[model samples]
Target: MISHMRRLLSLSTAMVMASTAIAAAEPSAELIAAAKAEGTLTTIALPHDWCGYGGVIEGFKAKYGLTINELNPDAGSGDEIEAIKANKDNKGDQAPDVIDVGLSFGPSAKADGLIQPYKVSTWDSIPDTAKDAEGYWYGDYYGVMAFEVNKDLVKESPKDWADLLKPEFANMVALAGDPRTANQAISGVFAAGLSGAGGDVAKSGEAGLAFFKELNAKGNFVPVIGKSAPLAQGTTPIILRWDYNALSDRDTLAGNPPVDVVIPETGVVAGVYVQAISAYAPHPNAAKLWMEYLYSDEGQLGWLKGYCHPIRFNDLAKNGKIPQDLLDKLPPAAAYEKAVFPTLEQQEAYKEVITKGWDTVVGANVQ
Candidate 1:
């Protein structure tokens, strides 16, 4: 009788879990109609070239007949937060309806009452570790840190963080953006710290900052934000950026300058970015619909085309939803088999360290 009761209880719990997932995922018909009526979504800090946002924006506009007003294509995570506070009361296109930011910023945004709760239709497909419990934010996609080199200017490709320090790479190294404000650059510092201090980002970010200080002093590091134009022009031949961005640049500039995308051997880091609805969204329903479309199978696959691994990658692969052509563009499965993801707490801790130390430690002026 006791065993039978235990089995019954287990089955009941499983059923409840499934029901909760379904409840969170299903949007009301009224909600869909209301979104279509609103027909616009304002966003900030989304660069079209980064993480396939160019295709995503075009696809979303075409699919729902909604106009997406994207502001500040080159802004950082910090800038997005500022925009939210600055335009909270403005009922205009300038006020953002949605935001996509580094995972570390999610908690702070929620705490500040800047973002609201809205679960996507594909909520269950996302990993529990990558989403807020109350649905305030959820990861969209991720990429690993990598060394992006312009082969035309760089005779030898850098295979690891250490290799970038060699004389051959002098005056060649640049970061995706400013570490103080940009998620990618902050993660780059963490990746370098892993190699500099033997995989200890929890307490050795200062060492990573020190490494950059040396890199700057040696004249190997350029004080410039990395972009495809700099790489193509040979101004910034080697960029330390996300793998997705590196791969995108390589494919985008196939023959002009020739690009080499290499995942660093020593300290590789995978960082996830999440999307959320603004608490003061002028087009709230449209914002919700936008999130739904992004998490849908179609949206995930669209991100895959740009080489970013969607948060639902494992789930999608298990369901056999990934297309072969897109899969062909990805690095070997082995390359990411042991990829490291620092916890949100860990990322927060490292952000504090980097933000506080960047000035006294490295301080490479990029004016």
Candidate 2:
């Protein structure tokens, strides 16, 4: 009787260990089967080079054998919003499963009720500041606003907000575009405002206006649009651009026109490239799967390889996935230690301040 009891106990222990191993080994068979049934995913994206989305498409296709159809819009965010509004009814054929756009447009997209809320399981891994509370959208990558200077143009590069105001940089500095038109340009203006460029503009409309007026007087202003490469190639010596865009230019112009990027001593405003799912998406399940994959450890590391800061900084740091050579290319993490978001109050204030300021300062001065 004792021998028989020992055999029964040992067999039960082996059965429990086998069950635990199976649970740890793979995803549920149900999920894999559902993904196979989804068939395809369609995406609409801003005008990023193939390098930006290529890896993601390849990864998704290899894992699920699903087809990915991508559409690149020629017009900006306004055009994308207009397209969605026009096609709200017959969505599957007309609308994309997912869309990517600039940061400022994220709130507007949410307000229009064009986006759906679906937080990935990895949501907690992303910082709260980088994502919407209700999961309407989340930022995948971001660039810090900085000065891209030509080494040959000025004896020394402008190091801070105050340096641009000097007489020496007169007619030598250029901005991306009118703040009313370009999201990046607006970020630059606000960053300057936050750093005391226009006195009290951090809290008042008059401050932003006064700063632009001073810039106009110093002859330190030029309005350039859509072409940062030519500007860095020496058409204009000093231009405002995001760090990655500037780095791309610097890499392209290795010997000629030699450009260098610097985060202004005052502060850096981080502008993001955000992604969201369409409210009327045909493949909602697949879209959710894509977002989940994007935030996973594998997908987040891809962003670091592509030179865009991954949204989950802590995860990347913990994994040691960010290489030393790449770390050398980026601004010190301290530069982003105190980053601030533009509050709803600031966005409202900007509509009036930036528009009116342009009329008074840039419009009056343009020949």
Q: Give lDDT tens digits, candidate 1, residues 1-367.
A: 2222122122232322323243235456887789889877898988888889899888888887888888898888878888899999997978988888999999999999999999887777677778899999999998899988898888889888888789888898999898888888988988998888888767657877988998988889998999999999988999999999999998889878888888888787889999999999999999998898888777888899989988766556655678888888888766665467888898999898997899888988652
- The CA lDDT at 158 in model 1 is 86
Evaluate model 2: give its TM-score: 0.74
For residues 84-158, what per-residue lDDT tens digits would candidate 2 score against the true structure?
Answer: 676678556556788776666777889989989987766655556567899999877766778888888776999
lDDT over C-alpha atoms for residue 156 of model 1: 83
Model 1, C-alpha of 145: deviation from truth (Å): 0.2
**How many clashing pairs in candidate 2?**
0
Cα-based RMSD of candidate 2: 11.5
Alpha-carbon lDDT, every model: 0.83, 0.63
Candidate 2 lDDT score relative to the true structure: 0.63
Q: Where is model 2 poorest over a 10-residue stretch in terms of lDDT?
A: 1-10
